[model samples]
Each structure stands twice: as C-alpha cells, then as structure tokens.
Target: MMLNDIAMIAIVGAMTGVTTVLFGFGGGFVVVPFVYQLFLRQPAIANNALHIAVATSSAVMIVNAGWATFQHQRRGNVTADILFPLTLFIGLGAVMGSLLAGQLNEGTIRLLFILYMLVTIVDCLVSRRFLKGCEARPLSMSTTTVGGVAMGAVAALLGVGGSVMTVPLLRRHGFSMKHCISHANPLSLPVALCATITYTFDGWGKIPDSGFIGYISLTTLVTLVVAGGIGITISQRYFPKIPDWWHARLYVLLLIAVLIAMLW
Candidate 1:
C-alpha cells in the first residue's frame, strides 16, 4: 500500500514477467520467495508467510502462464497432442497438492522447497538429455498420467508451477529449448487455476489483512500481472534470437539463482 512497497513489488513483477515468458515460470519461482519474505514481517501472518506466498504465486500464475501460453500458441510452439492429456491430470494433482500444502507447517514447506530446487538444478546440470534432445514424439499414456499428476501436485505444493518438471520432460522428447519452455505455459495454467481456487476457500479469513483474498495478496497479484504483461511483450521479440544451447544453459543458471534466493 505504501509507495515503497508498490515500487518494490512492481520490480518483482517485472522480473516475474521475464521469467514467465523465457522459462515458463509464470511468476511462481520469482514471486514465492519474495512474497514469503514480505509476509514474514507481518505479525498477523508471520507464521503463515510461506503459505500466503505459495497461494499468491498460484494466483499470479493464472494470468502470467495463461497469457504466455496464448503467445506460445501463436508461435506454433505448443504441442496440443501432448498438452491435452497432461493438462487434465495436472489439474487433478494441483487440487490435491494445494490441499496438502495447507496442511504442511511453514518449516516443512520451506525445507521441501529447498530440497526440490537442489535436486532439479543437479538433474538439469548433469543430465545430457536437457541440451540435445531427441526427435519429437508423442508422450505415452502412462507417462502423461503419472508425470502430469506428479508435476501438478509437486508444483502446487511448492508454488513453482510445472516449468521445473514439464520443460525437462518435454526436452527429452526432442523439443528445442524454446519449444520445451513454450509447452510449459499451458501445463502451468491448470495448476495455477486449481491451486488458487483450492487455497482461496481453504484460507478464507485466515489472513487478517484486508488486502488479501484468502491466502492471496489481491494487490500484489494485480501488480505482478500488469508488470509481467509488459515483460512478456518485450521478451517475445527477442526470444527467437537466443540459441538453443544458451537457452538450456541459462535455464540451469536461473535455477541456481533461484536456489540461492530460497536459501537466502
């Protein structure tokens, strides 16, 4: 509500936008840590800082991921055949995950978040499949069923969305870095929607502030969406110019940076 708060959040929003478009994060990775820290200072919500952060991250993703998916669709980067089947299961998992997240204590959620990031960063770094993927192939039913549900569940629980899982999964199927990340947008959309709705009702009247609607910060959500929109528009023009190899490398580096931020 203060000028400084608005400015700082807007900055975070801009960063969220860039990540959403470039890495299919949809503000999940950027918003969670920051919002967690922000809410920690409020006595009323201090104990639930991470909860509010995770829920708000989900809310922000609804717009960021959805819009990014639309843009990706125009570019012919989305694989509908692969996307449709996975999407349904992801939604189911997201509902389950959001419920689970609400039951977790703050410390437990933070630890799990840190551990998940470490594993993901290590996997992306050591895995040869991430850089030079194979030919594009249809995902098997079993793969989509298990992977989609798992991805949505974990993503909703951690508030990181499916980019961390979906992109890597798609990469092995021979998608270029751009296409792999592009596909993540659509996959993330369902997780955001389902998680936000679940948390909204589950967290009703829990946070004492008027600014929050359930566990989500209504003001921050709008700011991030607006700022993220500008960022997405700017990034789209330059996205195709990046080399695939660099894209893969940068993704890993971004993961590392996020890991450090979480720890910090």
Candidate 2:
C-alpha cells in the first residue's frame, strides 16, 4: 500500500471507531457504503469492489468485538449459558453466506443492503414497542440455534457486525439493554471471525491489496482495530449516562446517514 492508502485507512479507522463506540454496531453498515462510494470516485478496485468492502469490514469487526466483549464480560454481561451453543450454527452459517457472496451481483447485493438498512431504521424508530415484551424465558437449544443461524447469514451478507439484531432480539427476550449489548458484542466476534475466514477462502488468489488472510487489508484492519477498541472502551464507560432522547436522535442520525450513503 502507498502513503495515500495508509492515510485513507487511518481516516476510515477513526470514523469507524467512533461509530462503533456510539452505536454498538460495527462500522460496516456505514463503512461499506462509504467504501463503495470511494471506489466509485477512484475506480482502483474492480467490479467486485463491494465484496472486498464487506469482507474487510467483517475482518475489522472481529477485532473490535473481541475487545468490546472482554470489557462487557468484566461488567458481568456475557454469559456462557447464552453464548456457547449459538456459536455452533452462527459459525457455519457465516461460512456458507460468504461463499455465496462471491457468486452474487454487486447491484443486487447493494440494493438488498439498502433495503435491509431501511428496515433496520424503521425498527429502531419503533424499538420501544418491539422491545416491550421481554420475558427471560429459558431458550431451547433449537430456538437459539435458529436465531444464531439467521443472524450469521445476515452478518455475512452485509458485514453488519451483528449487534443491531442481537441487541433487539436479546432485549425482546428479556435481557436488559446493558446485558444485551454485552452478550451481543461477544456473539458478534464468532460471526465476524467465521465470516472473515470463509470470505478469505472464497476470495483467495483473487482479492487485491488485502493483506493478511483474504479480502481484508492489513493496514485498514489494524487502524480500525485500534480506533474501534478505544471507542468501544470509552463508549461503554459513558453510554449509560447519555439521555434517552439523545440516544434516539443518534439512531435517527445514523439511519439518515446510512440512507444517504445507500442512495448515493
């Protein structure tokens, strides 16, 4: 990579780190669209540009999630009772999804990603109602597996870091917001790690400028990891003190930015 590439990665990393800290979601929901636009402006990458973007985002998330999970665990949020079994299917599903991503068209993937983001926005707006009926029931092994599989598929397809769905699902199922975020952070690590590994295999021998294993650029990954780690640590410390209305507004702003990126 050139000096310009290093600069770009650092800039992207700082931005991504801030977003992950504030939102508890990986930056890919923002990063992939931005990367797509960047590629459009420069045209250095090939037609499969978004795939590389998605893969790279997932790769970064693995590191970010690991850091966040550790802190969350220390706060008594992560429970093996909830996390262990889910890993089984989430791992497999992410691999399958990454393998499939290679054969899909960029336009189709982009549109689907946009649509999903819109739905997520709507869900965020209506989250209080959606999260109202939390009941902490003991999850059967089957139900947990199904949920994990579904989450893994979506995470691989969009490189979304897994917290958006995981948080709400956990909340609706009776987990507190703090606990939900904690569990979700660790859960995301497995999904991101699996997807990154699978995407590496699928893109092997073809992906460009991606440094370490496959489609993720090493410089980009390291930069984001550092920024995201700091962001998550700080955010977790201060998040609970933020007011609810402000939090709502933040989510709205995120949705608007994501929508604009998708449309652009």
Candidate 3:
C-alpha cells in the first residue's frame, strides 16, 4: 500500500480502537462503512464491496475484542457468569448471520443497518423504565440466551462487535455501564471468529488478491489491531471517570453519527 493508504488505515484504526472500548462494541459500526466507501473508490472490488467491507470489519474485531477484553479483565470489570453462556449462543448466531449476510444484496444490508440504528435510538429514548426494572432484577437465563443469539446474528450481519445490542440490553437488565461494557468486550471474540471464518470460506474463490483472504484485508487488519490496542489501553484508563448519564448521551450521539455516515 502507498503511504496515503497507510495513513488512512492508521487513522481509521485509531478511531475504531477508541470507539470499540468507549462503546464496548467491535467498532464495526465505524470500520465497515468507512471500508465500504474506500472499496467503492476501487472499481476492482466494487461488485462485492459491501461483503468485503463487512467481512474485513468482522476480522478486525477479533483483535479489537481481544485487546478490549484484556483491558476490561485487568480492571476486574468482567463477570464470567454472564460472559461464557452469552458467548456460546452468540457464536452460533454469528455463524448463521454471516451465512444470511452472504445471501443478501448490498442495498438490503444497508437498509437493515439504517433501521437497526433508528430502532436503537428509539430504545434508548423510551426504555428508561424497563432499564430500571432490569437493574433491580437480572434477566433470566433463557432470556439472556435468546437475546445473545439475536444480538450475535444482527451484529455479525452488520459486521459490528455485538456491543450495540449487548451493552443496552445489559444496561436494561441492570448491569452497570462498566459491567455492561466489560461483558460486551469479550463476547465480540466468538462472534468475530465465527463470522470471519464463515466469510472467509464463503467468499474464498470469489475474492482473489494477495493481500486479501476471502473478503478480509490483512494489511487493514494488522493496522487496525495495533492502533486499536493503543486506543483501548488509553481509553480504559479514563473511561471510569465519565459519568453514567454522559455515557448514555455519548452512545446516542455516536449512533446518530453512524446514521449520518450510513446515509451519506
């Protein structure tokens, strides 16, 4: 890659890393759209640009999630009781979601992502009562399992780290924002791995390039992982000081930005 491309990748990686930790999501919300636009500029990959973008974003999350999880674990924020079961169900769902994504057209995927963002905004705005109740009583096992599956599926389909869904759900279930983020960080690992593997084989022969394996770009992955690691480490040190109310607002604002980026 040229110096300009390297520079762009580094910038995106830095942003992804910070957001991944900040929101406890895989950063796919940021990475996929940007990569999609970048791919669009290259006529060679335009035909499968969305697929490549999504898959590559998922692949990058493997590293992003690992780094974030390590940071959270170090802070004693992760709850193993919640993490393991959710990871299992989410991984299964991620496989299914990746397969489903392969069958859909680009326009449909984009539409789904837009709708997902809109629904998230509405949920955040109207679910305060439900959240309070959840805080009082944790969700049942069956409910958490079902929710994990659904979250994993949607996240894999959209190339996100499943945090967008997990964080809010956990918050509603009464998990502190820190706990929600901590749990959400590790869950991305299974989802990313399953989705990445599925996408790799699904697009094996379809995408032919030395730097690419199926739809993933190794150069981008490496760059993002390194920069993301730095971002996560820095953010974790300061995130605890941010007030809870501000976290909600920041999450909402981030979603809004993602919405605009999608529509743009």
TM-score for each of the candidates = 0.96, 0.84, 0.93
Model 1 scores worst on lDDT over the 10 consecutive residues at 233-242
103-192 per-residue lDDT for model 1 (tens digits):
899999999999999998888877788876667777888889987899899999999888899988888777888888888989998899
Off by over 4 Å in 3: 129-134, 237-240
Cα-based lDDT at residue 179, candidate 1: 81
Listed per model in order, the count of residue pairs whose N, CA or C atoms clash below 3 Å is: 0, 0, 2
**Could you say which candidate leads in lDDT?**
1
- What value does the lDDT take at residue 187 in candidate 1? 91
| Cα lDDT of model 2 by residue, 1-264, tens digit | 557766776666666665665556666776687666655454555576787778888888877777766766777767898887887777767776777777888888888788877887777667773334345766677668887788788878888867777766665567655566567667777778877887788777765544545666566677767766666666656656544345445645776787887787
For TM-score, the strongest prediction is 1
Kindly report which residue stretches of model 1 are placed more than 4 angstroms away from their true locations once superposed.
238-240
> Tens digits of per-residue lDDT for model 3 on 38-123?
77777777878888889988888888888778877887888777877778899888988999998998889988988998998889
The C-alpha RMSD in Å for every predicted model, in order, reads 1.3, 2.9, 1.9
Q: How accurate locally, in lDDT, is each candidate? A: 0.87, 0.70, 0.82
User: How would the candidate models be sorted by lDDT, starting from the highest?
Assistant: 1, 3, 2
TM-score of 3: 0.93
